[model samples]
Target: MGKLIENKWFLLLIIALTWGSSFILIKKSLLVFTPYEIGAIRVGVSGLLMAYIGIPALRKMSKKVLFWVILAGFFGNFFPMFLFPLAQTQVSSSLAGILDSLVPVFVLTFGFLFFGIRSRWIQFIGAIIGFIGAGSLMYFSEANREESQLFYAFLVVLATACYAVNALIIKEKLQDIPSLQLSSAVFSVWMVPSFIILVLSGFFQNFEASTPTYEALGYLGILTIMGTAVAMILYYKLIQNTSPVFASTVTYLLPLVAVIWGLLDGERFTIWYMVGGILILIGIYLIGKNKKPKLLS
Candidate 1:
């Protein structure tokens, strides 16, 4: 069991499962809270929880390391935390999951462009295919006819870009830090800011005592503890143990889990959406093929 826990593949699977289900939690939480409230509470709560480990780690960081940590936290956690919930306001959870697969392609693109990393032609081709699929996904989306929904879908893509930047920062700059310490410290940076947002969003003033409110809060708790906090620890560990592109491959499994949850929730699932998702997955496969193989051990 302990050995399995340490295995990168196992950690990948666990993070996929946890994060995939997060969409539904967000959807459910949205039943009672605004996107701002959900995002603020999720980040603020997760940050507080992480502070237990992070405060100690904070004491040990030099200024340079702290800057990278805070940057990673912003791109990786803070913005995406809000963007996703906002996107899901108009987009389906499954579609949000599908769009997230763009992370690896963007990772490759940004890595090659800014980080002095070299890439093969095949990877470039994969990036093109991935963008085509993403464009098709958005174009064919039921939401495309509506300007607001289309804008929201783009937000999800933008969030994926943020995630890509975060991954590169972790791989290039913060690789030497312990994964848990790094994750805790990153999340800790947003703790106070998130709480400030929560308060400013009128979360306290609009408080209600109702069954739905309690249920939404419960979902938020799970989303924070499992989806944000625990999954982040494992995700950082995976990134530290493997390449960022490889770690982002968890998105391949993430959509499947999210689609299942969406279906169970009775959300619409169209054939075109599936076609778009398949294209994205194929693009990811080609991208993965371009990677020099890593031993699964």
Candidate 2:
């Protein structure tokens, strides 16, 4: 049992499952809480839970490191946290999950353009393919005619861009830090600010006690503890044990889990969705195909 827990494959599977389910959990939580409230609570609660580890890490962290950590936290965690819930309000959880597969594509694009990482022509083609898939998904969505819904889908795309930037930061700057310590410190940095936002969102004043409220709060709890905190820890551990590229392959499995959950929850799935999804996956495979795993410095 202990050995299984230490297995990298097991950890990867768990991360994929936890993160994939997070979209549905966000959907469930929105039944009672606003997107702002949900985002703030997720960060605040997860930050609080990690305080024990994060506080000490922060104390020992040099200001130089903290600067990058803070930047990473915002792009990686903060903005995406809010963008996703906002997008989910208009877009289905399944579609949001599908769009998230764009992270690798954006990472490749940003890496070449801004981070000075070189890419092959094939990778450029992959990026274009990825964009085409994303556009098609949005264009053929049930809400395609609705400008607001299309805008919301683009929000998810924007969140993926933020994630891509964060990924480059981690790879270029924070690779030397212990993964657990880095995650803890990042969460700790945003803890207070997030809670402040929670209060400003009127969560307390608007709070009520009812079965639906309790259920929504329960989903938020799971989203915080399992999806954000635990999944992040496991994801980082996977990076330490393997490579970022390998850890990121979790993206391949994540959409499948989300699609399953979305279907079970009665969300619509169309033929165009399948087509777009396949193109995105194929593009991702091409983007990652030429890259060999290099051990973190």
Candidate 3:
């Protein structure tokens, strides 16, 4: 983690593969489960899986630290877990990808507004520019021309804002916990509520997984472990290691990865898509550089 492994680009690559593909997985899972149902399972299963993996670290964490992890889970996973799937039902997977790029923008905004961190205008501008591309990509590639897409976009925005809140919470409240412990605890917390909702909602009462449904569940299961379980742990660690905006470079890279995955899978890309994607990339580059450049002493 010195000069070699812990580099920002390395972390970004990890995040790109993990979070970027999540929307694609979510699209598949939705072919069977309702958004609420998928939301419940993905978080519940991932939390349970990681809880076991992170046990020793969890035992080392203080109760005070434990609480922050729970809070992080609520904002980070719970809200977005439900929101993204619901949004995808109304929008294209590609649009979902672009919309998610706004997380860093909201993350930066929350950092300054709530945490009293000195505002970086350049960073904020970059964030906005990124969102501009993101929004355009989303708007143009929409699978549905219905008004529901607008509603879904708002929900995605809310989800991104939740990401911002989780960021500030992690920085100010959970700074003392080991990143792995924080990740485990938060994920574990998500399971309780998600399971409870799953039960109360009777989401699985019909429980019919056709072969394809079963395959979709398998995809979700893999996504739960890889995307939610493993990648989220890394994200928590990155937040601890760097500023939230720095951590949020994941947003920029992830969408491009999603775009590539979609394109390879035969999703069409138009001229507007290329133009919009380039704008988003430029915005990300600018926003990511806003952290005071570290000069070699």
Candidate 4:
């Protein structure tokens, strides 16, 4: 209905600003904390919050749904959460951002591969081109940087693949689960094993809890609750009413929002970003849609 579309767009606007600011917040947080610690705080807080909010619905999901939810938490959040920081330690944020743009492609491919769904070629190509435009922003002159860059790129791409995999799994296997409950359940399930390992490995003591660390934890909380949790609902609702092509437009905006936050954080800004963003936007604009085929082939 008109009400849902208007509501979803308004919610997405909040997601944009909040998720965009998360980049700057994460960058600032990384200054003092380890990546694992950040991931822990991020998912842990959001999971706890959502579990509280969606307690009844979460309790209602079948055990099979819980299994898929746990899988999503691990692949989508746990694995990627660790990979991103480890990879970023060696790779530039620009490179990581570009590589991470593979989310939609992976989502579509996984949907087709395991779920047996076919996507419209134009939408697929447009998403890929948008990724290329995002990727080009990361390219810079460096001697023989190709090998190392490619490795880090794979890690980033893998993270996005995890995301896409979760998307499909949720759509196929866990569609009966409520969005808010699913988001919280996934995070909470992942947080359990993560926290246990940190404690057993003695990484828990290393958490210094400095001012920036606390601030970063706060940002991660925001990222988990708003960006991951709330945005999950918004995106799910968007998919219900809008075509996948239009829904995927969120990908085009995410990186642009990241770039915008980078500028706001006083990072170097150049005309190339404008060009890349324009290309991505154009690609998204060209790929408008009114119908969504079943993700199952």
Task: Report backbone clashes per prediction.
Answer: 0, 0, 0, 2
The numbered model that scores best in lDDT is: 1
Q: How much lDDT does candidate 2 score?
A: 0.85
The estimated TM-scores of all candidates read 0.96, 0.94, 0.86, 0.78
**Which candidate leads in TM-score?**
1
All models, RMSD in angstroms? 3.0, 2.4, 3.7, 3.9
**Local distance difference test values of all predictions, in order:** 0.89, 0.85, 0.76, 0.61
Q: Give the C-alpha lDDT of model 3.
A: 0.76
lDDT of 1 by residue, 150-255 (tens): 8888998999999999999998899999888998998888989999999999999999999999999999999999999899888998998888999999989999
- Expressed as tens digits, the lDDT of each residue in 1-297 for candidate 3 is 555436767877888788999888988888888888888888888777777755666677778777777677789978889998998887666666766777677766666666666655677777778778766765665543566556776677688789888877987788777677777777777788889878876766878758987898898897888888788777877888787777877876777888887787677667666777677667767666665533222
Considering lDDT, which of the candidate structures 2 and 3 is the better prediction for this target?
A: 2
Model 3's C-alpha root-mean-square deviation from the true structure amounts to 3.7
Report the lDDT tens digits of candidate 4 across residue range 1-297: 547545757655655565555556566656766666666666665566666655565577688777787786677657777777656555545445544555666666566678777667776776677666656644531111655564554666678778677666666676766555666677667666667655654556776657766776676666667666676666655544443334555665577677666666666655655565555565555444315555442
Q: Could you tell me the TM-score of candidate 3? A: 0.86
Model 4 score (lDDT): 0.61
| Stretches of model 1 off by over 4 angstroms after superposition | 292-297
